[model samples]
Target: MEVIEVKDQDLASTLSNNSKVVIKYYADWCGSCRLFNPKYKRLAKDERFQDVTFLNINAEHNPEARSKAGVSNLPSFAIVENGEFKETIFTSKEEAVVELLNKLN
Candidate 1:
């Protein structure tokens, strides 16, 4: 599983470079994010999401980028494909993300 850490300055370019990008906006102090971290990492290791690039951005460190993505929640997941915003899934369930990846295929 590969996790890319994104910062504000390189975010746009990083998103543009990948045809499919799965970004998780999280903050260290958020309890929900802490709980979801392991599951999220497991999802990244799954073969189903191999083609999708996984990125983890610290929302607290990049508020501007978080606002740009409209992340009102602590643990937010966004799927961006072809530089276009696709869908967002906000939940602690790993199944939700697995289901979303299945649909993508």
Candidate 2:
């Protein structure tokens, strides 16, 4: 699945509507965030993640969305299941993201 770009207005509903979700919080000025875009896309299309919803929220512009993940880094990942925040990791590594995704399965 392609990553869905979410803003503050749609975050709450999106989380509630999806069963399992992985949100990638980023800032436009962060180099690491930009570099991870393609990798995030590849992971979203991963067969193991077929049942998960992938989301992208700009940390700089969406304070409410960032608060969901307690985002403190340029690239942070959070897993939300059944509209509840589960776990989050602050990382720029692809393997770390895979680790986060593992929690859903």
Candidate 3:
């Protein structure tokens, strides 16, 4: 598993026809977002989530991606399964985010 940095320009294509993906919506200025960064990256490299695609989107720079994911807060997580938007969890807690990603696996 590899964590891909997503930009506004890549959002559409990234989400299109995606089988399984977990997107972390974050902004550089957010303290909580910064705190969750390391754990997010670690989870991306986790063996259990090998089949899942991990992505990171900077909300401030990628408004379209944030809006598309219905993310109203920083450090949110969105899951896309089988080309359909599944759920979005607005939380900065690494544990919560990891729990959600584990569900995908």
Candidate 4:
């Protein structure tokens, strides 16, 4: 699936509309966040997570989305299932993101 860019206003609706979602919170100024972009995109196409909706929200600009996802660091990932927040992970490691995706199962 494609990674969609979500804004603060549309966040709630997006969460409610999708059954499984993995959101990547990032800031343009953060080097680690930039570096993880390709990996994230790759994961979005991953067969294991094909049912999941992939989203990108700029953490520095989208306060509502950031807070809703419980973001605590520069590069954080959140999983939402059934319109509810399931888990969050703050990491630059692709393995860590995969680990979080596993929780969705």
RMSDs, each prediction? 1.5, 0.6, 1.5, 0.8
Model 3, global lDDT: 0.85
Residue-level lDDT tens digits of model 2 in 32-97: 999999999999999999999999999999998898789998799999999999998999999999
Query: Pick by TM-score: which candidate is best?
Result: 2
lDDT (tens digit, per residue) of candidate 3 on 1-105: 678998988877887745789999988889998998888889888888888889998888988888878999888999888767788999978778878877776
Superposed Cα deviation of residue 97, candidate 4 (Å): 0.3
lDDT for residue 3 in candidate 1, whole number 0-100: 81
- Per-residue alpha-carbon lDDT of candidate 4 for residues 32-56, written as tens digits (9 for 90 to 100): 9999999999999999999999999
The candidates, ranked best first by lDDT, are 2, 4, 3, 1
Cα error of candidate 4 at position 20, Å:
0.4
lDDT of all predictions, in order shown?
A: 0.82, 0.93, 0.85, 0.92
- Write down the TM-score of every candidate: 0.89, 0.97, 0.89, 0.96
Best of the two (1, 3) by lDDT: 3
Model 3, residue 105: C-alpha shift (Å): 2.9
Write down the lDDT that model 2 would get: 0.93
